[model samples]
Target: MPVHQRPFLALGLRLGAALAMSSLYMLVKLVHQMGVSLPEIIFWRQAGALPLLLGWILLRGQMWQLKTTRFKSHATRSLMGMVGMLANFGATILLPLAVATILGFTTPMFAVVLSALFLREKPGRWRGLAVALGFAGVLVIARPGAMPISPIGALVGLASGFMVAVVSIQLRDMGRTETPLSVVFYFSLVGTVLMLPTLPFTMTHHTPLQWAMILAMGSIGTLAQLLLTAALRYGPVSTVVVMDYSSLIWTTLYGWLVFHQMPPASTWLGAPLVVAAGLVIVWRERVRARAAATPPEESAPAGRVPRGR
Candidate 1:
């Protein structure tokens, strides 16, 4: 209730939620480092998530709320999500989870540009600068200037960012017609379907412990998303976003301590700028949302009509 500390407190919540999600990413990287194949990783993790997601909805007795009038759009969204997952996982293997996430946060920046170009939504000036800055940050981390680069990790990051943006835009349009539960069900359904083709290709030699880790990856992601949704019900989004900064800290620590994988100093320097780009995008979007929600100022006509004529 203290006014002065509100920003501080809100920051904590978002950071905490972000950290929770980051831990999931860390687990993925660690498991993958143990030499698990991407398809196998995705299969176990996403499959593990499905039952828990359904169970939670069932607990709320909202399972029947699922619908599918926009099957095409739902399928598109899910495909985009699957691609994003692939790129993201590959990035995790190529770089530290924290570094990949910093690169991944470019999603919001991509969303801004994609929304402008495709949806005809005009973003503010700051978002434009953020996009450029984000690219620069990528250059810093990728070392395009001084050394040979595979471009695979960078490409994967960009691809994941792009696909996620498409999915987000799809959701924006899809939201006008689809119920949240319906959309969620479709995402799970389509993702499962798309993932099926790759299932036969996945490494099937995971030990029980690796399977457990994979299961944890999927389960925790679903739970974290749910918890984050719950957390927002109790607190403001700005607080939650700021709290997400904690993910950076947790992921960085997890990547360093557990993996002993450290990035070049240039990467460490650029990461803050990358993260700042995400924060700025989130802040700008929140401000825009608030402005849009505020009713336009009303003015009496030059000549007022009689009331209830």
Candidate 2:
């Protein structure tokens, strides 16, 4: 099947990625609450995932494909990715899971705008409307005028969302020439190396359970990253990323079940608008794909019968 025809598959991968990422965020929150510093958490999240990523590459016998002329791109992506991770993790620590997750939904809005600006993927009228609706839903949920979140946390969360959009555009470009495994592997490797310098300052002894949770963060995170990269590889950035709004469901569940924190009534009120926006994009993409795939009928000469008729 053509790549453009796989929106359903991309949607599934994106939804799975969302679930895995929300779980990772929950773990990050738990570990941070248990006294792990942000730098230490970042280190473990990347470092722990590196070996697993390497093993996956080796298992697929694609180690040789890791070589690329795009190291500069990889470096830029890695740096942006690390900054995004820090802001995302820090937000998770500072805010409620639902709030952080809702804030992250801004990624799709940014992705749509950046895709138009950088990737040159036009946001048609439907997509533009969907992004606008999604943003309105986010405002309803965030309720800046009434919410009690720290201003710094809100800024960091927004930064994370913007960086995520930037990285998604980078990945869309990179995916053209690099295999998904190569992109993910290099990110883990570079992230691990870059974060190593902070170990001396941030490392601390952890109980065995804490260590297990840290490792789990890495494992889940690696899976989420791979799924996300593959989804972008298989679909348009704006279409695939809008699916990330699904993460709010998983994050809300984690917040309720694990942290015993219920989202405000505003969340219930606003979430459907966000979800509806995603559905609009998905429906529009499918329609567009079908229209592209269907060949136009040939016109007959004037006063002449068509060949078959």
Candidate 1 has which clashing residue pairs, if any? 10-239, 11-243, 14-240, 14-243, 14-244, 15-243, 15-244
True-structure Cα RMSD, model 2: 5.4
Clashing pairs in 2: none
lDDT of 1 at 265: 78
Global fold similarity of model 1 (TM-score): 0.78
Error of 2 at 76 (Å): 1.6
lDDT (C-alpha, whole model) for all candidates: 0.69, 0.82
CA RMSD, predictions in order: 7.1, 5.4
Displacement of residue 183 (Cα, Å) in model 2 is: 0.8
Q: In model 2, where do residues sit more than 4 Å from their true spots?
A: 1-8, 115-129, 281-309
* Per-residue lDDT over 1-309 for candidate 2, one digit per residue giving the tens place of the 0 to 100 score: 133437778879888999999999999999998999999999889888878977877898878768798999999999999999999998898778988887776776676677688778888888899899987887777678786565677777778888887888788888777877788888988988988999999889999999999999999999999899888878877577766877888888999899998767887777677677767766766676655666555343567653310
